[model samples]
Target: MLRIIFWKLGFEWAMLLRIIRPCSDQRVYYFAFGANLSPDILRLRRIGVYETFDHVLEDTVLNFSQRGFYKNHGFASADASVGDCVYGKMYLIRQSDAKRMDYFEGVPFLKAHAKIVQQVQGKPFYFYRSQIPLNGLKPTQQYLNYLTHAYRNMDIVPSQYTEALLATKVLKTLEPQDQTGVFVRHLSRWPKILHPSLKHYEKHCHQLVEALWNRSLVGWMIRV
Candidate 1:
């Protein structure tokens, strides 16, 4: 009966623990493809990132979302499209720090939504993308400068990112989505077996695999 209820709720018992435990020694990896790539901006914003790295998430495209950028007349937010690849920085942050960063990025709020986790190497890395609702709008000079500056500094400029950005254009829309996210909107068909509930456990189910890796009996293989 307990298992049936958990299954019907489409979550595991572990979700309750996740709600209660906001702090953990296990830090998570976050990919920042947008303005958050700037270390100076990150510090100024005081996002509390534990450590940062330059990384390229393969097979994802980048484009602008959101209608405005701060005080600028037209500012676009960086969002990922499904097809191409995007270059950006990765931040290793604690659970608490991650929360602050997400809030600043409008996670679960604004046009941008919560992080959609992807894997790098072998661990989990959440991605944050912005959704822009207006069309024919361009980014302000200052906004472009921030992105270009960060790209050059991060070695992303020499790559195809700049050219790709030059080609991508915004589309016009009558109504804007409140916070319809990149990953969440399409997650209606996600694997039912992997959701979180109040007392469930597959995220922790792997015992022999991890133990084998630790004992040199097996190696860590990255699926992605």
Candidate 2:
């Protein structure tokens, strides 16, 4: 049946991606400003941290503009803004761990694989930015809680910065009949058939975005 063929194709594609995916053995500095800021969350994600430091990304402002898988909520994104800065912790992690992070971040799908680099204490640090950003989205309380815990745990200087994060507006409750959740739940029932199709769809989307992102005009528009 066509379903079986697609499933096989999808499985093979996934394997190919894993094989071709570039992974570095060396370590790199990753700047965390979102949920990854929480030590507990980082551990849960299985990213081994070698060291941590208080850092700031200059000429940027933290915004909840990145669309999340969960409807009605947004994830943290650092937008370019003159004379502004986003404070967070810098984590030194293995390159393999960074690849793991890409999976969780929905890289090449929800988020682009493009690295947003900035000078932190005279060294280059990397961070992520959403592939497509929308304005005026608020984070959920649960997401904010992770950030709250992180800010408390790390000694981010200029206490007011963390205070601003705490003050960010949050969606206190998710809808009882969250349609996305329902759809995902139903879709999970037939992973064997659906998984491949879903992966292909993600791959197609990533290719499309990458094409547009490579266009200078389109890329500039996306940043602004």
Candidate 3:
């Protein structure tokens, strides 16, 4: 009888626990290889950014592939490249922020999420592998500025990576003009404060990197 009563009590405890904690507030670790790496864009727009770190994505290469998020054409995308590493930022963010990032990355339309993007800390790190068809797409200099700025600011990126980025050949198409200059100026502005928000400041510092790392950007730059 004591064993039977104990079993019942344990079952009830388990049920109660589930009822009280329907779900745990789980955070997500996300990696960014493109303009999303800009902290200004992540914070002012994407809330719930918890923390971040500079990381190098292994066995992958970065490039401007497919049309941009706005229509800037051929935005930054990544593909598997043997014997190469890509520089990027890893973020610890709210799960909701990760979902919103899906929208930003056009996950619903792109069908890119098959599995966790890559492994980190012995776990999967969700990411977007942008390998859209590349055909005569070119990124604006303003978009380019964001990337170069990021590199200039962050010493994490190797000199050769910056050189390879600047060396990428383009078809020299009638380069699409954009107001990215104003947007870049806005994101680069430093806040006047004694103790800036770390996450916010981290974002600022991230975007503060020289523009050479930025080869493409969101399509909405047309509206900037």
* Candidates in order: C-alpha RMSD to true structure: 15.4, 12.1, 19.1
lDDT of 1 at 107: 45
- The positional error of residue 90 in candidate 1, measured at the CA in angstroms, is 0.8
Candidate 1 Cα outliers beyond 4 Å, as residue runs = 1-24, 69-82, 109-111, 131-134, 156-160, 163-224
Model 2 regions more than 4 Å off: 1-25, 112-114, 121-123, 176-224
What does candidate 3's lDDT look like per residue over 48-118, in tens digits?
Answer: 55678888888877767645423245666666789877787888765545654554444443332322466
Worst 10 residues of 2 by lDDT: 215-224
- The alpha-carbon lDDT assigned to residue 123 of candidate 1 equals 88
Deviating ranges (above 4 Å) for candidate 3: 1-24, 69-72, 110-116, 167-224
Q: What is the C-alpha lDDT of each candidate?
A: 0.50, 0.61, 0.53
**Candidate achieving higher TM-score, 2 or 3:** 2
How well does candidate 3 score on lDDT at residue 33? 70
How far residue 114's Cα lies from its native spot in candidate 3, in Å, is: 6.9
What is the number of residue pairs that collide in model 2? 0
Count of clashing residue pairs in every prediction: 15, 0, 22
What TM-score would candidate 2 get against the native? Answer: 0.64
81-161, model 1: which lDDT tens digit per residue? Answer: 566567778888666556545545544323344467888879898876554444445564545556666777776546566
